[model samples]
Target: MLSNPSFLVAWVFKARYFPHDEILNSKKGSSPSYAWRSIHNSLDELRKGTRWRVGNGRRIHICEDKWLPTPTTYKVTSPPTDFEDFPMVASLIDPDTRWWKANTIRSLFLPFKASTILKISLSYNLPEDRLIWVGNKKGIFTVKSAYYIACNLVDTVEGACMNGLPTMLNLTTRGVNSSGFCPLCDKAIENLPHALLHCDHAKQTWSLWQDCSVNLVSLILDPIDIALNLLEKGTINDLEIFFTEFKGACTSFSLHQNPSATSWRPPPLGFFKINVDGAATEDSGNSSIGVIIHDSHDTAIAALNKVLLAPYTIEVTEALALLHGALFALEMEASYAIFESDALSLIQSINSGVVGGEIGHIL
Candidate 1:
């Protein structure tokens, strides 16, 4: 609703039924109703993540409003006070060329900030300021994103520490009768970090799950920090697997139990495993399909690669690849073969024998 220019204009100028502009733009001289006050309070929270996309920038204030790409409003060591009228962001742009006045911006703002502001490309065709949700990729706001923002704001390390799950060291500090040594590894003190990440048992569990040695010292001090770093550095599938394995490892450790050993086993003596994969180029809309068949001894018996005519959705391409792989396996005179694909949804649909969707026909 806030993104609609017509709605905003009406609220600001039309006062026959509502005084939205007066209430929003100016402080209430007198006490407002409870509902009005509640709305005003919510607006304060909303303002934190909201920023303006520069168009003509006529409506954006130079110093007070959050028009910059950075999180804070524009500031300087010394502010000018002799001007007759406060400057708008439009004043910084060249009227003739419709480009930022580089020299003027450099003199007015900090060097880095001036460069950032100058990088903002403005279109003369779009003359209205656009409200953008800085928290989202598309600059559009949603209640789901707002809920997550609120959760992050409310969550704190202190709150987590006070949730009654005290470590052995914490219990000892509080005069509880307990051994301060780690239960898993008696060599180290049983602090939170030691129990979760540094103990020999914990390290072994992590190594088993991650298929690599665990280095406690290399990890972030806080789990939240590690999670945020992983979110930035890893893919969604990586995070999902990490969380699932970590949870199981922690549960097993708490129970003082070791994880059972498991190894990949090849298909039955007579059967072969056909692994199929699909790739699509997002820019060119081109796709390719590949398949490789391995016998019981895990030796590649046959392989095939075919360039698809046109790009298709990932699910469709994967289904097509699986179909091609099955045909290739039959052509090679394989009586019993297991089709495997990384596309879980396609595999599940094939197993269920219920294929009815966008890519269902391919299956």
Candidate 2:
């Protein structure tokens, strides 16, 4: 509650010390306590999920502030005739009716953008604007959701293996399991390669699975070893088939569960469609990208979700997603794949070859 004076810490500072400013706008005072100064470190993390929940809209800036629910640029992208004219979002509202001035919005912005503004329902008795979390569907934050996000953002495979993704061998070594044998099958010691590849249950699953490229189970090499070999050999098709098969198998292996909503569509008779999307919190460096591949038959061949180490403008994130999508398609041997993204500016720039911003380098 950095912006709210109701919280104990915020109230104390507001009442006695920084009466005129909140934590977000206030500076570290002269010779501040170590604990007070340390709070600055987490302010970036806090800003990532914060967005103004429009009420009277007096507190939000029309172009500079994040009040809209839309992605990419949360603020208005359609340049105003004069930035100073509508500096505050309140200027665009019908103060007496406590509703948006619809015609004013239309004249002020592009038609599509005006529609977005119109869709925002207004309250009869307009209240003060307050910050809300956009991490979940509901505008509330929960530790359960936050923890889930943190765990998935692990940067290293070894670190991920140590976290929640453990094989029977890992459990046994940690004294969590009596023997290394998989609980599902007593066939052999269950290391990652064995449970996911050589186990009889895994073998049956792969034998019946629809792969875009290769029948990895039929190969003499271990499944994990084959993936490693493909990376070394620089062969795309076999690499694609191997991972596609494994990604499908991972659902049964109980790796990561994705909760993001997706709409499905089949590609052309001989092509695959690779749909890509990127997410970022405003002013928060935390960003992630996702790619999902579907074959002509509408079967999901493979999917990947990754958190980027460096944050970029949403445009660059989409460009990065496109880049990753192309690489993933190449790895899977989908030479006839089509890339799809929500960033219209990026796509238009790609076609024109007159790119701008950080995404230009990625393209």
Candidate 3:
């Protein structure tokens, strides 16, 4: 039910379960069920992760509606008294060229925000406004995503426990116990920082995960400070991997054992492997493409790096890089070459012999 916008709008309006022609049209009504009322009250939270994809922009008010990428509505520190009378978003766009008026937007909004708004391309013929669910990659809401979001918002205690922080250490400090000795390490008190960073097992685990070299025990004095630093700078994937490995290493040490190391294998003989990758900057829309050709022995034969023009999505950039890599291999006159890319969607599309979506032409 959460995944279907038309159904949700009907539900919110207390209309019949059947489809309605004016579902997207603005109307106010009420639902008698307490559960539905509760859900209706929480719609504001859902709106935070949703944005309007500008089309004709006729229905969207410049200052009231949120069409910008930023979370906040379009606003300025100080404005003219008649700012409320400013025209719809369509006014800022030139109908003849179907492009945003650069000078007008610059005068109305901050320079950075104005530039971001300009980069978004409108259709040659104006289309209807689209409400995109930014919470999911496909721009559609799901109960699973909503559940996770709710859990994140309401389960603070569970979050701290899962992070391996020692919340019970305060009991020992209040004279509830003689000492807060660590269960895993008998040498030090079982404080949050000590268990996660300063313990002997933690030190060994940190050494094994050599990519991140921060010595939290030495550099950070308070556990809260360390948490803040990590929260501010850490990537979700990096933090998850770090904690999983750290806990596994600690458990192995507790059992007086060592974890086995992983080994890398080379490609099969008689085939040349070509690896291609691409990266795009969100702020500037600039992209870079890279490709490398390696033999069965895992020795590099050729490499190329090229900077591409602005205004390309990450998927499009990756597809372009793959095409360039294949062309490069053809130029080298290589036989039985194996192309590889990190994008599984591109690989699947190529294997299926079906090209679709915005980058369909390029593929």
Worst 10 residues of 2 by lDDT: 248-257
lDDT of 3: 0.60
Candidate 2 on 246-345: residue-level lDDT in tens?
5434432121225436665688999999999987655435568999999998899999999864444465566778877888888999989888887776
In candidate 2, stretches whose alpha carbon ends up further than 4 angstroms from where it belongs are 2-4, 15-18, 83-86, 143-363
**lDDT value, residue 72 of candidate 1:** 29
lDDT of 3 by residue, 332-354 (tens): 77677988887777888878764
> What is candidate 1's lDDT per residue for 229-346, written digit by digit as tens?
5667765544444443333233311212233264445788999989898876544455689999989998998999997654554655777798789889989998899887777767
Higher-ranked by TM-score: 1 or 2: 2
TM per model?
0.37, 0.40, 0.41
Q: Candidate 1 has what TM-score?
A: 0.37
Between prediction 1 and prediction 3, the one with superior TM-score is: 3
**Evaluation by lDDT, superior candidate among 2 and 3:** 2
Off by over 4 Å in 1: 5-35, 72-86, 147-363
For all candidates, the clash counts are 0, 1, 0
Pitting candidate 1 against candidate 2, the one with the higher lDDT is 2
Descending-TM-score candidate ranking:
3, 2, 1
